[model samples]
Structures are given as C-alpha cells and as structure tokens.
Target: MCCLISAGGLNLIQLQKWNQAAVAKLCWDLAHKEDKLWIKWIHTYYIKDQQLGDCVIPQQASWMTKKILASRYIMLQSYLPSPQHQSMIRTFYLQLIGDLPRVQWKCLKFGNKARPKACFVMWLCLQQRLLTADRLLKWDIEASPTCVMCQQDPESHEHLFVTCTVAKTLWAKVLRWSNNQLCIATTWNEFVQWGISSAKGKAQQAQLFKMVFAECTYALWTERNQRLFESTSRHVDQLAKDLAVICTVRVPPGLQTLIHSFQF
Candidate 1:
C-alpha cells in the first residue's frame, strides 16, 4: 500500500481506557472478515497489510473510505483484541458514550427501572428545558403566561414540576405510597437535592423513589399537554390512580407493595 508512517499516536494501551484500544483492535481486524467481498477487496487493494491506524490515506481514496479510516482518532497503536473477556466491547462502548460529568441521579436516569419514554421526559425535566408556558411566551408563541396546573403563577419548570398544586399533590401521593420520609419536602429543587444526596443507595425504596419520580414527571407532562392541546383533563386523583397501575406494572415484584398501597 502507498502510505506514510504515522506521527506517533501509538502509546501503551491500558485496560482502564479500553475504549481507545478496542477501536484499534477492530481496525486491525478489518482485513480478516472473509464473509464480506467488498471489505476483502479494500483490504487487498488499499490496505495491503499496512498498519491501519497510522497509515496515510491514498489521494484516490473515496470520501467514505477516508471517513471509515478516521476511526484512527480513537484507535491505539499496536493494540490487539483479546478473547479474555466477552464484555470488554460493551464495557468499552459504555465508557465511550458515558464520558460525562458523573452525577448522583445517573442511576435514576439509567439504572432505575423506569420506562424509556418516562426517562426521556425526566431528562428534559432535569435540564429544565421542557416547553413550559413561560418558555413558549419568551419565544413569542401565543401561550398563556400562567401555570397550567395551578393557573396561579407563570408556568415555568419550577412551578409546573415543583410547586404547582397539582404537582405537589401528585408527588405527595407518590412519595407517601413509597413510604419515604422525603414526602415531607415539596419542590423540584428539593427533590433534585434529595436525588443528589439519597438516591445513591441501591435499596428497593431508593429505586422506587427514582422510578416514581420519573413516572410522575411523565404523567404530569402528559396531563399538561392534555389540558393545553386536547382541552381535556383528568383529575389529579385519577392521574394518581393511573400512575398506580403504571408503577405496578413497571416496578419489580418487591416494589409492587408500594404501588398497591397507593391510596389517593
């Protein structure tokens, strides 16, 4: 292959940083997949046993070819894949995508057994980026400047998710059902601080707290949409009952006791 030597991205690979090393190993294996005819052609005509990560791209290489080879940014020099652990690839992938600042609610976000849709809403709630009325009005959209849940204050993330009468009632019911002491506190910021301080435990109640938190956000947001767009609404009690069924279905058997005991 016509190529130039690399500029020393090669370094000793560490098991701790397997995300980089694994990519290098996969690039090393590009020529070995015998089932693919096109890949074999590329291997024979373009690569020809040249070190894949550090080699220069041919001027005639297609844009797609150059793009494909750009995996070298993550590839460690001289790294080779091992059969030592089957989970290494998955571990590497999680590490690759999870390179974010660690937060306490991460377990609630990912490890809590909430539904995917609920978790997505919970993410938006955490970022306070939900399209509440205040945000819509700021964007010059013709939206009510009052809270939909209470109609007493501007509908912002803090009011809608935290202090509104509807939200306070729903979270009180949900938290009380979980038999958590946290039911005493009412506010989104308080709950967020609670997640930061207490949600780190792996206990069943802790998991239940996280699951119901996300579930309640999903329910409240759905209720808000129903009132705003559909011009239909359910009572907060009905929302609680719906969440009871949902929590019963979403939670594990041990946590069902909590959901089953949801009285209001």
Candidate 2:
C-alpha cells in the first residue's frame, strides 16, 4: 500500500479505487473464518423452512456468500480509515474551488480555476508558509516581521500582495495602461473581493488587466527569489518591463495587435 501511494504516478481516481480494494481485503480477512457458521445458519433456517433439497443448498449458500460480501463492503466503507488519503482529497477540493472572496472572473480562463502556480502560492499563504523580509534577510531569529516592500510593521499575505509600495506601483501601472478606475485594497481578503466585484468590460482593456495581474505576480516572485538567492536587486521599471513582455506574449492575437500599436 505504501509503495502504491509513494509511486506518485496514479491519479486520484486510481488511488481511491486502490484504497477501496485494500479496505475490502481487510474486511474479508476479518470475516472469512465465520463463513462456515454463516452457511450453517442459512441452511438450518432458509433451506429447511423452504423444504429445499441438497441441490438447492449450493445455490442458497452462494447467495448467502454474496450477501455477506456486500455487508462487509459497507462496513469497510463506514470505517473512517485512511485519514491521510482523506486529507489529500480535501486539499484537492480546496485548490479547485480556491479560498476567500473568490476571484472567479480572473480564473475563468483556467477552466473556472486559478492557474496551478497561483493556486499553489495562495495555498502556501493560507498555510502560513511565507516569512517576512527581515527574517529572510537577517536570518533574524526574531523581528517584527515587516514586509520588504513597504517596510510597514509585520508582513502578511495582504501586505505583500496589495498594501506594499511595490504592489501599489504595479496596480497603478495596470490602471493607467488599461485606462480604468480601481479602488486600492489594503488586505488580501479585500483585494480578492474587489477582483470578484470590479467592473470588467468584455473588451481588450479588461483582458489586458487580467494578463497584467498574472504577469506582475510572476515577476514579483521572480524578483523576490533573485534578491533572496542571488543577492541581486532590480528597479521597478525593469520588473514592470519584464512583466509587460510576459503579458505581451500571452495576450490573444487581437489584443496583441492593440498593444503593439502603443509606442512603448
């Protein structure tokens, strides 16, 4: 069973079927020794009353075996075993639906879900896997944990994504380029809510904003990694230009034509 799970190749449906079979095997082992007793009782009660002869005994016994097998199947299902497998199932569902405020509009292109990378980062934030800039820099055993971007005390998902100066700059550029009005959000929850509720015209500009948001997020993480691992720094213009190049590559042909018309 461990080997099957550790193979890392089977999909969810395959894993579920494998677990069901395992459970059934365990149930059958527990009940196998009682098979004779069950057959005896069936013979004494079901066959004698019905006046069935010896030939019918085999048929009746086969029927009883099937009944007992089904009963064991149900028992196995109800056992509440495999907690680790259950947790994996739940995590899969959570990632599929996403969390908090719900940015379904932006995720529509991904088959009504966020991109895998975006979903993974969001899950990490939900699980509190990220550390503050000071901790990242000082290897600080302890600190107020302010964000590197804004340096306002105590970093968190909200601060890093929406409230930081770097994030604000990115948002401003998006608004300016798309020629749209946007309300700044101070918290992660609020940003997600705004993403869901904000007016998104079915036009090139609206589509551009979607690309901009995804590209900026990818670029921001790239910059963060560079700073952490390579001891390198980047100007905001450079980051934005990188993001623009990525967005240009991903934009639909119609939108790409519009973007190309710009002097920048």
Candidate 3:
C-alpha cells in the first residue's frame, strides 16, 4: 500500500493521467463547477468504495495539495470569497497568483520600487506596451516612425528612452550632477542593470535610485507622448532641470542629504 501511494505521488508530479483512471471521469461542464469539485477529487482519489478492502488515508490531504486545488477554483471566478473566509484565503490566493507573472520579470526588479504612476509607465515600457511610433509602424499604422523627441533616427524603446539626443542630454546632466562619470546606457535593459549596480549595497540609496530612475522614465515617456499627440515638447535643459526638481520633491525625508545632489 505504501508503494502504491508513492507511485501515485510520482504519477501526480509527472502529470500522468493515472489518477483519472481510479474512478469514472466526470464530464467537463460538471467538473468545472466549484460547489462539489473538491468532493469529486476526494472521492476519485481517496474513496474507492467500489473496491472491497481498499482504504485511503485521510492524512494525505496535505496543505500543499489543497492550496493547488484552491488556486485553480479561485482563479476561475471573478467574485471575491465570502467575508468570513476572505481574511483566511486572501494572502494565499494573492501570493499564488502574484507569483505566476513574476517569473517573466525576474531580470527586471525595478517595478513597485517607486511612485505608483511612474512605476506603472516604467512597467508598461518594460513589457513593450508603449505603442511608440516604431511599434505603430510595425502594426501597419501608416505613421512616420522617426523619434518624436529627436526627429532623427527611427524611434524605438531604446532610442526614445535612452539613445535619443535629448534623452542622452538628460542622463548626462543627471550623472554629472551626481558626480558620476558613468556613460548613459544605450538600451533599456542595460540602463536598468546600470542603475541596479550603481545603487547596490545601501538600502536608502537603492530606493532613491529606483525612484529617480522611474521618474525619469515616466517624464521621458510623457514627453514623448505629448510630442506625438499634442505637438509640444520641453528642451533638454528644461527637462533635465524639471527631472532634478521632481526627484528632489519625491526623495524621502530621511534621505534628504542626497537631495541636493540631484539639483543642478
């Protein structure tokens, strides 16, 4: 019996269909209904009433196994769980669902580290959802694909945010003011890597860097959109000064010492 249970565990891990063979398979529509699916899984896997002398141990109902089942059911419904059970299940389901997409962004840790609105735009930029002119042209939108900010090279995630002449000016100014001689990165990923490395070790500086980086990206993207849609823009010097002021205002009170470093 122990060997059979071990085999069953291995089969489940391997995603084998052996468990379904233990009982008659239910139809799809009925299987998806939430009210009694738990009961069905229990009966199919643990209650072999049809076979004489077969007894499944109730002790095998482990928390991990139950969590997997609960996650499946909870995700299928849009409505929240009842008030009484909300607190108990909230953290489990949230962590379970939240962890799903994080694997895709393991290399990008800048999200959720700064102001929400700015972080939101930066997140969208990381996901390549900005719909810049270059992207629009790829979708056959029949628009000029040149960088709206520089109006020189074809616009892209890298060019508009990093390599554009205007953008390069902003970064150069910021780096100079901070007394750092590091050159501005040419690509978005490289920029993120540089920011992470530059601010490593000190927690306050790391958070400050994240906020400033996110704000800069947000300002740049907003400037791009306004250029595209509103036909207005800021000069590189004014934009850089605005970035410094924005960063100064957003800096935490405890980290006020470094706030002057951002001001021109």
Residue 65 of model 1: what lDDT?
A: 66
Better of 1 and 2 by lDDT: 1
Best by lDDT: 1
The lDDT, on a scale of 0 to 1, for candidate 2 is: 0.51
TM-score of each: 0.70, 0.51, 0.60
Least accurate 10 contiguous residues by lDDT in model 2: 1-10
**lDDT by residue for model 1 (206-239), tens:** 7887788889999999999989889899998888
Model 2: residues with Cα > 4 Å off, grouped in runs: 1-14, 17-144, 198-204, 261-264
Candidates ranked, most accurate by lDDT first: 1, 3, 2
Model 2: pairs clashing at backbone N, Cα or C within 3 Å: none
- Look at candidate 2 and tell me the lDDT of residue 241: 71
The TM-score measured for candidate 1 stands at 0.70
Q: Using TM-score as the measure, which candidate wins?
A: 1
**Backbone collision count in every prediction?**
0, 0, 0
Residue 54's C-alpha lDDT in candidate 2?
A: 22
How does residue 2 of candidate 3 score in lDDT? 14
